[model samples]
Target: MKRRPRRTIPATLTALVLLAACVLVAIVAIQLAIGRTPIISYRSVTGTLHSIHWNDTAPLIAGGTCALLGLLLLLAALLPGRPTVLPLTGDMDAGVTRRSLRHALQNTAATVDGVTRAKLKLGRRTIVARIRTDRTNTAGLTDAVRGALDQRLDQVAPLNRPAMKIQLRATRNAP
Candidate 1:
């Protein structure tokens, strides 16, 4: 089945909070049944409930707080998280992490002729490379890097091919 990943921390936290609340309620119920004083007195809780009114400022504030919390949780559940791994082209359930892909692309760029050092910023839609060369004339270096990157990308075979952007910089200006 095709399944999207969930945000683990938030879901885990929510579950833990609910579990704690249920445990507390169970403990309170047991105390009441055994004729012992509950941690939070049942009389106080009943008194508070009796005193609460729909039109009271306290109820309004409590309702507003609950609504806001519900809205926040809804947004968290609905919004997609940042993708750490990009899927491969084949049928296998295999994928490459962004860090590894960036490393591979940087290596490809660095191996190209006239490229001294290569730094890559791999975005969602593009791979931007900043290459440094000590050579005075960098005539066809950009194209060479691009071609090499394309070849490497073909081998990698990611599902979504990002556009390549090459920025060549000489160690020192020819002028």
Candidate 2:
């Protein structure tokens, strides 16, 4: 049986978030159990009752905030950087190969009419292309892109009939 590839970022982030939430809850519970009050101690600078208070609530709040922030950061790191392209899955060693295939697919898609840019994602068994096109002719441009990719890159087995997403944006003036 073939072994499946593993990508841990998503799982790790989820675990981190869960763990942080648990820790925050535990801290809050502990503070509550301790009566949620500051302990004050008195010392003398010049034979006076100058007091110092150890605030258990402050520590609990601070710990909870830090844990929550850490969880948020982990989640943010795990999220995809932008929504410009499709999502892909593959082994670590296939990065370059996948990137090259993606570039080729993008190039092919960009050749279609009204397409301003193309972003491609190549997975282990499938490929997806996202095309940015002018709003006026997006459907036509998408159809043309699909046709062109099907004709030009059919030799690439995994990507022969890739799924295509066309996003219509304002046409930019060429400089």
Candidate 3:
């Protein structure tokens, strides 16, 4: 069965709008406490009891707000989301989350000599690592990162062996 993406944002927005509507209703209802007629009247300018009266600008503003909300909800429903986990190779349905894979790759890259920090971006077809190192010779760092990542990939054995790209950066204050 396919899983539905959580409607966190939309749900929150809906709750907030409903709360605002309730507040407006309460404000109108409060006229009872003071024994005064409500600001929103049922009698029109012609004084007919069956007709309703409303400020002209208020309805337009409320309609526009509702329209904007509907548009946002539609966009949220239609947009595709990135999955959290990527399936790995094997007869079993094993998988690793992107966060875990990125963490592992970053740690692996950081083990290279002179490397102070590492960041990794994992995709279906590519694994890119950006490394910051103390050494001016980035050629060696690139080779080391590639080899380490290859060994890590072999161990994990993901469904696809994505091509690795290394970006080496020199730290300004490195000794």
Q: Candidate 2 on 1-175: residue-level lDDT in tens?
A: 1223343565676688899978876776676678874222112322332242335666578779989977876766665442222233333322224456677777888887677777777654455776775555344665677787887555454412455554445565344
lDDT of 1: 0.89
After superposing candidate 1 on the true structure, give the runs of residues whose Cα lies further than 4 Å from its correct spot.
1-3, 83-85, 90-95, 110-121, 130-147, 165-175
**What is the C-alpha local distance difference test score of each model?**
0.89, 0.59, 0.79
Model 3: lDDT to the true structure:
0.79
What is the Å distance of residue 41 in model 1 from its true position? 1.0
Better of 2 and 3 by lDDT: 3
TM-score of 3: 0.69
lDDT, ranked from best to worst:
1, 3, 2
Q: Could you estimate the TM-score for every candidate?
A: 0.68, 0.37, 0.69
Best by lDDT: 1
